[model samples]
Target chain A: MTSAILVSILMTLVAASTPILLAALGELVVEKAGVLNLGVEGVMLTGAVAGFAVAYSTGSTGAGLVAALVAGVATAMVFAVLTLSLTANQVATGLALTIFGIGASSLIGAGFVGRTITRLGPAFPEALSGHPLLRAVLGHDIVVYLSLALVLAVSFFLNRTRPGLILRAVGENDASAHAIGYRVIAIRYAAITFGGALAGLAGAYFSLALTPMWADSLTAGRGWIALALVVFAAWRPARLLLGAYLFGAVMTAELQFKAAGVTVLPPEALAMAPYLATIAVLTMMSLGPKSGRANAPACLGKPFSAS
Target chain B: MTSIITRRRFNFGAGASAAALPFTAGRALAQAPLGVGFIYVGPVGDHGWTWTHDQGRLAVEKEFGAKVKTSFIEKVAEGPDAARAIRQLAQANNQIIFTTSFGFMNPTIQVAKQFPKLFFEHATGYQRADNVATYNARFYEGRAVIGTIAGHMSKSGQAGYIASFPIPEVVMGINAFHLAAKKVNPNFRTKVIWASTWYDPAKEADAAKALIDQGCDIITQHTDSAAALQAAEQRGVFAFGQASDMKAFAPKAHLSAIIDDWSGYYVKRVREAMDGTWKTGDVWGGIKDGMVKIAPYNDAVTPAARAAADAVQKGIVDGTLHPFTGELKDQKGVVRLKAGEKASDELMSKMDWYVDGVQA
Candidate 1:
């Protein structure tokens, strides 16, 4: 392949991976705090519509990003209240949230259909971003850089920081953390809210940066893929980033091959590449080394009540 | 929900009372305004396939003001869920129902059997029964028009087509586009990328970018989102919209569009149902019937390209140009049609092979 084609492929890969990486990172933190929020899909949808609507009406992409974060947090709060406060079943609530998100986002985004907005542009100056080779590294929007920074920040917080240690303690053993007066429920709530915000930002990336248009189900199950990425990464932020890019590469390969007139496989088979890779990686993780699976939070998916 | 139940019960009770009268009186009682229902496979907010159908539904409301009442359930899945939704519409006393996707064919037939008195219209489907009528637009005609324009404007002679699936309808479009482009420039090459979905914006955008990266100067799509057009606009390539006008999303990159206009057919069908003249038949209307409309050309298109596109559209409408005319060959160099003949609807409906110069 020519350098130009390679650059284009890498750019598309990054664009595709950023959203899932952002969402997966948030889910990693939520799971680390001993909560399994299955409502990521619904929350992301809410964020997507909220972001597009605000951006379109106000003519400000920044305001749109903020709205998306708030919407995602608000949607997550609904899940938090039902599963955390009301002691509802986490799996059932998460699934219900997804259904609710699909319906609610479509209803909310009904008016914004067919509307367009100025896309989120590059973070660097035109001279630097416009160069052929430099453009590959500098041409990405601000969210792409932010997503990478979040991966590093999250990695540090979970390992080096005191609060991070305490949060991990809460996830590892909520009863012990509660006995130590760590406010287990409150920490878990905070983690869930933070996760929701990141997920919202990821969703906003879809409307404000990725395609810059609003359509029903525009995220198109990428939220579910993000959920899968968390599992594939074994709930680690660093691994989550790697897994997102791997998935993005697999997805981009299908388009690249078809565009290049490579007919080694039918288009149908090519389209299945990403999902096939996901299953294969998950299988390898299970059948190979046990360290990855062993890293999963001990109290993950278990609802805790101090009373 | 309770109010709907109460209304249904009242309608049933009234129908029972009306049925108790003589046959002629019962027929007169059925004249209490035609109730029409529509079931969409996707959300109306898709702004493409489902949106066009919803527009047709709105036209029905406008055309028959007080004479008809219409309702719709959006995003109904195409399997068992479709049958349940169709049954619900039938039970609600809707005299006519429109199932607006090929996936709804069997479900529509199943529900039609249960409610023999109700009329059912299935779009882009071949199946029909005593109460079910099939309707579709010749979208390939629109494809040919845009292909002609692509031929004139494309400097590289490399056009990219983003397809949703490998269904015969989509295959026909790919073949039609390739044939028309080749007629203008024999060396014209077209690339086909299947996104395997009808409405995923992210995937559609990626496919468009991939096509543009491979040196395609023009892009066209069968997917139901404006993402491809937006991608083309961002990448500085030309594209044509599918199913609906998408000029607002990509003003500079959008050369023109093929809009599905179902208003005329919808109004006529509703009138027929109300007049007790509804019949089961297949209706495949194209440019002549005004079912398929090409949007206005962009100023970016050269005058020569615009004239060529107009000529092809006029020929199709006037029955002079056959998009699937004779002397055609598949990608394998096997002759599919002999000279001095036009492709019949039956052959076109089942087209599965690509034409020469189309890279699938």
Candidate 2:
């Protein structure tokens, strides 16, 4: 294959992986804050529909993206109030939030379906962005760059900063953190809401950039893939980036090979490739000492009460 | 998560259109309108397969006027949940229900037995029972025409087929498309990328991009989305739409679309059920029956390509053409059909191998 083919394949991998990376990065922060929200898929849909609707109505892809983030944050707030403020069962409420997102987005998106808008443009000028080799690094839309920057920001926030330490401490032992004068529920609410906003952005990438149209459940279960990716990454931001890209490469390669009239494995097997990898990573995580499970938030999925 | 189902119930009489069927008005006014139920696997807004079926449902409403009330449940999953949904409609006084997805075949059959008095029509499935009937459109008939265009128009002598799965329905399309392209340019090649999904715009677009990058300039899809067409549009290539007229989605790239017209058959079947003539059987309607049709040719199509495509379309309708006529060989050069012999419905339904020059 020519270098052009290789470059194009790499480009496809980036497009396919961007949304998952954004969602997983936001989720990493939420998990690091000691909360487990399975509503990533639901939140993404809510964001996707909002983004498409706004973009279509205002005729501005930029407005659509802002609407997606705002909608995502708003929707995530519901989960926050329920689980953090009211002390509802985190798992059940998260699941319910997902259902709410799905139904609500469908209802709201009914009129916007089949509508198209200008796709989010490349982040750089055409001359440099479209260059044969430069395209690999600069060909992406704003969301792609934002996603990468967010990864670094998230990784730094978790490992190198004072508040990051406090947040990590809260996740490690909420009771201890509370004794140290940190507000456990407040920190969790903030984390969950941030996760919601990112998930929304991820969903908008589908409508605004990927396919450039609105459809119900347009994410098509990618949010679940994002959730699994967080686990696959062992709750680490850097690993999340690697896993998302690796998974995207496998998926894009499946189509690229078939389009090139070749196949290394059965299509069905390729479809299940990521889940198989996730399973292998999971088994190794459990078997290896402190490499996998050791990294999970201590207070993950557990509800906290100040009293 | 809470599942989202776009439920559209045509309760209000279709206003003045109801006046067309006045002959049955007195009897209809004396009783509740016949309850017609439909469940789709995708949103009506899909503007693809489910959208066309929704059009059929609307035709039923328009034809029967106040004599029949139609309602549909969209985004229905084809699983154990399907059986529950089917039963929900059955028990809700739906006299005749249409389960419009292949995966709902078993559940439709199962529910038909439990409600033996009600009629059920399952699309794209062979299963049948006393109260159940099967029906589908010959999409490959339309494929042959598009394949002709692909052959004459492609600069690379290659076409891309983004398929949903390796099911016989899909395999037959790949072959029919290739056969016509081969007839035009014997050296024409087809690349098959199984998307393994019925509807996913993002993945569909990705697959189309991959195919275009690999030199297949002419794109066609068995998957139900205009994303492939849009992708081709962005890349300045040619593509055909599936299940509906999608020229709106990709005005530049769209060569044409294979429209699924279920309105006539749906109206006929509903009329038969009301008249006590509905029977348990299989119905495969094609161009002859108006179940499948090609959209208008784009002006970009060379006059010769248009003429060849029209001839095949007309021939299929006149019974002078068969997309899978004899001398056909699999990818391995093994003859699947002898010259001058048309393929059997059974063979087409069970086709599992690719035709010569088709890379699967």
Candidate whose lDDT is highest: 2
lDDT of 1 at A106: 76
Would you estimate the TM-scores of all the predictions? 0.94, 0.94
Candidate 1: list runs displaced more than 4 Å: A264-275, A288-293, B1-31
Candidate 2 chain A, poorest ten consecutive residues by summed lDDT:
A286-295
> lDDT values of the candidates?
0.87, 0.88
Model 1 over residues A120-139: C-alpha lDDT tens digits?
98888878866668989998
Where in model 2 is the C-alpha error above 4 Å? Answer: B1-32
Docking class of 1: medium
Model 2: per-residue lDDT, tens digit, B2-110? 2333343322233323344454444556775787889888778788888999999999998998788776777777766788878877865568999999989999988
Which residue pairs come into collision in candidate 2? A99-B1, A99-B2
